[model samples]
Target: MNHLRVSGLRKRYGEQEVVAGIDLELRPGECFGLLGPNGAGKTTTLRLCLGLIDPDGGEIEVLGLPVPARAREARRRTGVVPQADNLDPDFTVEENLLVYGRYFGLRQAEARARIPALLEFAGLSARAASRIQTLSGGMKRRLTLARALINDPDLIFLDEPTTGLDPQARHLIWERLRQLLNQGKTVFLTTHFMDEAERLAHRLAIMDRGRIIAHGAPRELIAKHIEPQVVEVYGDGAGRWAREFGQAHSERCEQTGETIFCYTHDADSLVHHLDQRSGLRYLHRPANLEDVFLKLTGRELRD
Candidate 1:
């Protein structure tokens, strides 16, 4: 059975609708990714699911309980890592987890017993007594994640969990998340990083302008929406090259950046065509989540 189910979820603020008719399901032990540009309603959808805000329309069932009405109960089994670190600067790493555990009705003794494990899980065992202000950006993020897990939640919600972190920090978080999934915990996440989504999500949904534009496993989405291979040709004479290439391979050409990208199932055929042209540099690779996003949503700044 699905761990979380959302159907026709809608939310609006004043005259604007932020989320419109969104539907999704997350299975046990799965990492489900929500991808979108800013103001595309990814955060709004998460808030509705967590019952932080009431939805304007539709239904949300978390752990088999209807949301908002059963929000308190649902919250008991849920963990959340928001996009920003809302950690109190005055509190030490261990203090934050202790306080958060209290919100879930864990006794002081029980919270204390769990602190060591939680600290280790978040890679902050040595920094347990350190104040939040003294911690690095990555350390703070890890602490936030540790605090969320204090309740031993069955399902976790992470909003832009690895945003702005260095490569090492991101990988550490990813490794910890993978461990959770291996232990049968479900993770629901929103991120702008396509590589993160592709690496972590068992399945995902792409949102745009408050609606889901695509949904599936990362590989399946790529296979359905984009060609297996893309040949990108760049340089000053790219337009002329594109015109000439488009005449011979019109069905395969798409213009992005200062280059013409030829999409095809066979890379050799496209490479053969490009070989005849000079003053052009080319790269060939498999399609990815970013390619699908650009194809479906177009390349435009959301902000």
Candidate 2:
């Protein structure tokens, strides 16, 4: 059975439909990423899967159990690391895990037995007695992840798990998440960071205005939707250059504020064209997921 399944999923707030006729199926032990801008219905979709909210139309099966009907059964096998850290401020690091374990009906002895291993796994063994306020942002994030695992769930949902952390902290969390996949855990992730999605996700879906515009492996989507080369031009007269030669020289062009991006399979011709223009700084690089994202979603701001 698929780990999670959604077919014709639909939701609405008043007259505005938030999720429109969505479909998804996640296999076991793969990292699936949901990517989009603000107000793109990504969070609403997550809520639907988690049985936090009911969809007005469609069917959902999480771990083969129909959602909101068998939601408690599904939630027992699933874990969640929310966007915000909701760790109890008054509880010690170890105490937080113990308290969470209780929700799964773990006995005091069983919860205590899991605490040492969980703390060690999260690199918080030394801070077992420390208050939540004493831990750094990264440490707290790791702790939240550990807390979610108190019952050893098979599927984990991570919502922007590395949002505000430093690079080092982010990399640490990434490493730990990768380890979970190695242990054969299915990870469902949602994030705005393209690089993060490209680095960790085996498959990704980009949502816009309640619909999926693109879905596939990151490199595959890039190769299928966009040209191989991109030239970014900025500084003075960039707009003039785009207006003058964008249509003739490149397969596609996009302008945002003072910067204009030209996409092409033939970089040499575009480079030759731009060689004559002065006072405009340019960068030439291979197309990436961000290019695919922008091409599918356009350059307009969401909110």
Strongest candidate by TM-score: 2
| Pairs in steric clash, model 2 | none
Error of 2 at 126 (Å): 1.7
Compute the lDDT for candidate 2. 0.92
Error of 1 at 265 (Å): 1.8
**Residue pairs clashing, model 1:** none
Query: Which 10-residue span in candidate 2 carries the lowest summed lDDT?
Result: 269-278
Model 2 residue 230 CA deviation (Å) reads: 0.7
Q: Write the per-residue lDDT of candidate 1 for residues 18-98, one digit (tens) a residue.
A: 998999999988999999988889999999998989999999999999998898999999999999999977789999999
Q: Which ten residues in a row have the lowest lDDT in candidate 1?
A: 244-253
What number of clashing residue pairs does each candidate have, in the order they appear?
0, 0
Q: What is the C-alpha lDDT profile of model 2 across 1-303, one tens digit per residue?
A: 889999999999999899998898789999999999888898899999999999999999999999979999999999999999999998999999999999998999999999998898799999999999999999999999999999999999999899999999999999999999999999999999898999999999999899999999999999999999999999878888888986578998888889989999888877877787778889999999999998888888889
Q: How far is candidate 1 from the true structure (C-alpha RMSD, Å)?
A: 1.5
